[model samples]
Target chain A: MTTEAPERRGARTESPAKFRGNPWSGRVSAIAYPAVFLLLVVLLWWGATSTGMAPPYILPSPEDTWAALSENGAYLALHTWVTAVETIIGFLIAAVVGVGMAVIMVYSRTLERTFYPIILFAQVIPKIAIAPLFIVWLGFGPEPKVLVAVLMAFFPIVIAGISGLRSVDPEALELASIMGGSRWKTFIKIRFPAALPELLSGLKVAATLAVTGAVVGEFVGANEGLGYVILQANGNLDTAMLFAALIIMSALGVLLFLILEVIERISIPWHASHRNKDA
Target chain B: MMTVETPSPSTAVETDTLVDVDDITIRFDSKKSSVVALRGVSLQIQQGEFIAIVGPSGCGKSTLLRAISGITSTTEGSVSLRGDQVVGPRQDVGFVFQRPALMPWRDVRRNILLQAEMRGMDRVEARERCEDLIQFTGLTGFEKSLPHQLSGGMQQRAALCRSLLHQPDVLLMDEPFGALDALTREKMNVEMQRMWRERDMTAALVTHSVAEAVYLATRVVVMGARPGHVVEEFTVNLPRERDYEETMEDPEFHRVAGRVRELLGSASSHE
Candidate 1:
């Protein structure tokens, strides 16, 4: 019985995570199919306009949008820079403030009980609705736009931080206690590190919304930015330009979101869930 | 990992009482229910005694050990170490839980040094101690390896090193080998006995395995279930310097082991 134990246990080395799972091509198809579908849509769009099914004003087609984007690339870039600056600054503020608030909540149970629901309530009040109110208060400057982004981005962070801080394994805590760790030491070493992976997940979601927040703020009250450019183009019936601006905004969101993911990969490399794909 | 080849074992050099856990009774009360974890359990652990406390699940074997280490407060008792009342965790008592409980973020070397850093030991001295601990544990090459990277046995070894690094007087282990394969567990048990004999450091291990208790303990305490207490204590008349096979095969070892198994079987049947 003991002799057989060695082989039985050794056999467990061939884990279920082996077999290379399904090939990466299955996943690649997910991305590839979307791209192909999008290309087909664009082709149909160009075909519709070329066949004069829709007027140039109604649907300007892909070439017209590309032409518009190329023509205003420098001007659009300037507007993009405004939105980018606002988004980054607002995100930084939200990150610092959110984490700070979460620390306070983690340290005190009373604060968590008193303020957590209120924070969620603040998050639920649509950011676009609040954007106009912020514009009314802070005036039509970029301040309101940044403030809107900060508000939109902060809730996810706070909730993430709270859950992460509270989600520490009781067993790990017992080990730390045995090691004679103080509250601060335990939080820094155990609670904080455990919370990190969860908090990053929240930050990624917040980043997507943060870009949208900037645009919404601009839409409410702005003389500049992609949102303002879209409004101006709409007023002039430049549907192609409006679409180009929208695409650029989405691209920016995707770019920023991917960057956070990359940083998460590099920083918390030990996390099993954060392991990179084989491709 | 606690592999101390004590060619000359460290006898209780300090002629002082190391631990005095007096008249402990632990109870839990909630709105709907009340659970008794321990009832009037009293124990005094001397220096350099490898004491194994055995019982069934929820027998308060863990609770009793917790009270001893000052990890859990006693409802109706006081634990004194060096004649000081233990209200909270003390810096000197090392605890090895059933789980390795190693930090996921840190590598094995860093996990071992965690307690040393917390105690404000000199960084240079701490690093030197870590080197010695790694060598002793047969983990010299696995210094930079993370916890997830190592085997379960290896991780537990690192955890042992972590607890032992602070050089506490008493090492409180709560079924530290409960999660290991039998072969690895046997190897660890042998290693642990060797270290205990070498260090002669006061230890209290809570285990369900009767064979393990008979093998490792100088005093195998069989605990009764459901509001547990020490029902019987067996003194193993095994040789002081134990060889693995020699001691297990001894008729005296079987007599003690059989008695413990009977006690455990009867205790649980009654509950």
Candidate 2:
């Protein structure tokens, strides 16, 4: 039994280190693989365009796309800024409403039973299908786009928030009660902090969805934003301009995701997901 | 040395009792049926006494602990702490669960000081007590460390420190060291005994381990399963200053442990 115990422990401990490798070398390889893959993809695209295997009008050469981007740089930047503002505003509204609703639901089972199904049903309604309706109700401007973004981002936040709120260790709650911790005190100190990890994950999902929602709104009715630019480029058959607009939109999405990641790292260093990053 | 007055049999004992549980019955009503966890259970704990309750699983050991803390309401009878009926959770009674149950976000010091924070005690005094608790639990160096950073044993120690922060009159523990490894559990038993001996506190520990009950408790209560009730109580006649090496070798320890184990075995066999 003595020999068997050490052998079992050794087996359990050894595999993970072999798989993860040393931190320094692992970091280098992590960067190297992604960079190499990106370079190869760009090379293939350049080769396809340069060799005339793909038509310029269909998939414009990287240089043509770059030229289009530079020529209309100010216009694209303005649209990007408008879209970003709409996304941020919508995201803030969704977070407030979503978390508030979650708190109410978690606090009252009757409310949860009544509203949870309705929320789920609302989530299933295609936001894009209702985009035109939102435009008709609100307007052909940032308001419609912001509303759409909120609608898109609301469900995940509420679901995750509820799960997080309920996930507080029961023993912790009991301990608080025994310590004479008030309901508000328990909610603020124990429940909120514990729920943050799940809430942040929900927020991260919403961040990227916010961008898509804004662009969808712009596609339906807005006179500005990357979505409007894409529509115009498509109509004029300016593929390079369309490509440029698409690139900016994707960059916006990635930028929002990265920003949320940074916020998550700051807010929840105790979370297991951020442990390796802190290390 | 004092004059002996006419001592009433009931009042004298009642005044000395820190915790008086009188035939408390706990029933859980599910949709399908009613489950009786505890039936007509009575135990009176005096001040500065350490009582260990040992029983089979589903014997309502945890239920009784919760009853004392006022976390669970009894279906019948009453539980009184210091002669006052326990209606709901009270700050004067500290409770330790099977698991350490430390807050993940808070560090050792903050977690220990949580009781003080909840009660809105003086900040300076709370800090002093927090520091003393860290020292008492030998968690001085890891005050700022989060719960996950500590080992099972260390976290349990931090939890022990947290429960004792308010200097509660009675400490109710429900298998606090059940989650630890065997070696660590044994070590923690000695540590807990030492703490209990040093402090003027009433404690009740519920555990499934007969040996642990025999080792640490002043009185060991053997409980039966299925409508849990106290079957027998053994007063540990061993010396107070117990060491692992010496205590385990004591014949009285063996006798008490043997009796408790046999009681538990029979209790389960009847079920």
Candidate 3:
């Protein structure tokens, strides 16, 4: 039994590591496979445009798009900065307000019942449809764009926050009380930390949506931002510039999402998702 | 109704009783129905004594433990600790749940020191005691490990250390080893026995295992289900320092274990 016990444990430990695959191979493939796929996509686009299967007016060639990107780099950079700043500001506001609302709702049934339906009603309305109205109400500056971004980002954060805050193990709360911890103390020491994994996941979704929200708002009324760049390029039939703007805009979203992923890894290293990756 | 066995000479005195549970009843009321968890259940725990309450599943063994900790309120009677009514959670009691319930983010040492952090104990003294406990529980090497990194038994050891950090007078455990494998469970039982003796703390363990109750407790309280109440009790005459293998084979262990099993079997048969 003694010898068998060690053997079983050794197998149990080794099997999971083996099943997860070699870390170096996994890491290399994770990047390599995506890069290969993207290269194929770029090649396909190049072939389509070069062969004239698709015209430059509708779908610009890869070279035309790349030239557009470099030639107008300074101009695109400015608009991208404007949109990125608006998105970031909106996302931050949504995060704070959404988490605050969730905490209040978790603590007070009255507030939850009162605000839940209204929040749900707001979520059902497409922000794109209401973007014009925000432009009308807040008038042509960053306020309307920021508001749209906040609205877009708010729902997921609130939902995730509510679930996260409520996800604490009941026994942990009992342990807190048994140790003479106050309600506030339990919230700070247990509930908040426990909620971080879910809350961060919500923030990740919000980060991407905030970019979309800002662009949509800009589309409605702005004379600046990547949305404006797309609008002007489309009107003048500058397909390459349009493609350039679209690519940079998506890059911004991906960048924000990646930042959140890094934050999630740092903040909740003990979380199952992060720990499993390490194993 | 409850029946107490002949008490040992040390546990006989009223003043020596650290926990006095007087005919407490716990009821759970839902929107549709009210379930009686405990009906007029009563038990007393003496200072520095190990009392194991064994019963079938749903026999209010856990409810009784929670009531003693004052986390669950008794609908009918009262629970007193050291002559003071336990109106709310008392400061001098530590509880170990079935699950380790350690904060996943905290390492073993921080998880154990959580008790001190909550109670506002002096940081320097608490860390000193925390190291001692980590060593005592054989978790010295894994002090920096997170809950997920440790095995089930090690996680539970961290939990045990967490509960003991405050040095509570009474330690209430609710099926703490139920999740472990048989070998680990037996090893933990031996460690638990040693920890209890070394700390000289009053402990009440709730388990469904008859042999575990017999092996650990100075006294065993057998309870029945369906509006749970204590049916019988047994006083183990074994010495405080009991070897796991010898105690399992001893005739005294068998006699008490057999009787307790018989009582539990009959009680569950009625259900």
Please give the clash total of every predicted structure, in order.
Answer: 1, 0, 0
Superposed model 2: Cα runs more than 4 Å off: A1-22, A277-279, B1-14
Q: On residues B1-271, what C-alpha lDDT tens digit does candidate 3 reach at each position?
A: 5566676433465568889999899999999999999999878888888999999999899999999988888899999998899888777898999999999999989999889888889999999999998888788778888887777888898999999998898999999999989988998898888887777878999997899999999999999999899898899999998899999999999999999999988887887
Name the DockQ score for candidate 3.
0.52
Query: What tens-digit string does per-residue lDDT give for candidate 1 at B50-135?
Result: 78899888889988878877778888988898788988766678888888888888998989888876666788888888888777
Deviation (Å) of B68 in candidate 2: 0.7
Candidate 2 positional error at A238, Å = 1.0
Residue range with the least summed lDDT across 10 consecutive positions in model 2 chain A: A1-10
Question: lDDT per prediction?
Answer: 0.82, 0.86, 0.90
Writing each residue's lDDT as its tens digit, candidate 3 over A1-279 gives 112221123343466787776667767887899999999999999999999999999999999999999999899999999999999999999999999999999999999999999999888999999999999999999999999999999999999999999999999999999888778888988999999999999999999999999999999999999999999999999999999999999999999999999999999998988755634
lDDT by residue (A81-122, candidate 2, tens digit) is 999999999999999999999999999999999999899987
Model 1 misplaced stretches (Cα beyond 4 Å)? A1-41, A44-55, B1-16
> Chain A alone, model 2, TM-score?
0.89
In candidate 1 chain B, what residue range of length 10 has the lowest lDDT sum? Answer: B1-10
DockQ preference between candidates 2 and 3, better one: 3
- Evaluated at residue B110, the lDDT of candidate 2 is 88
Residues A1-279 of candidate 1 have per-residue lDDT tens digits of 112211222323345337447668657886999999999999999999999999988888889999989999899999999999899888889989998898899889999899888898998998888788898899988999999899999999998988888888887787777677788888887889989998998899889888988999999989999999999999999999988998899998999899999988887888877543432
Better of 1 and 2 by TM-score: 2
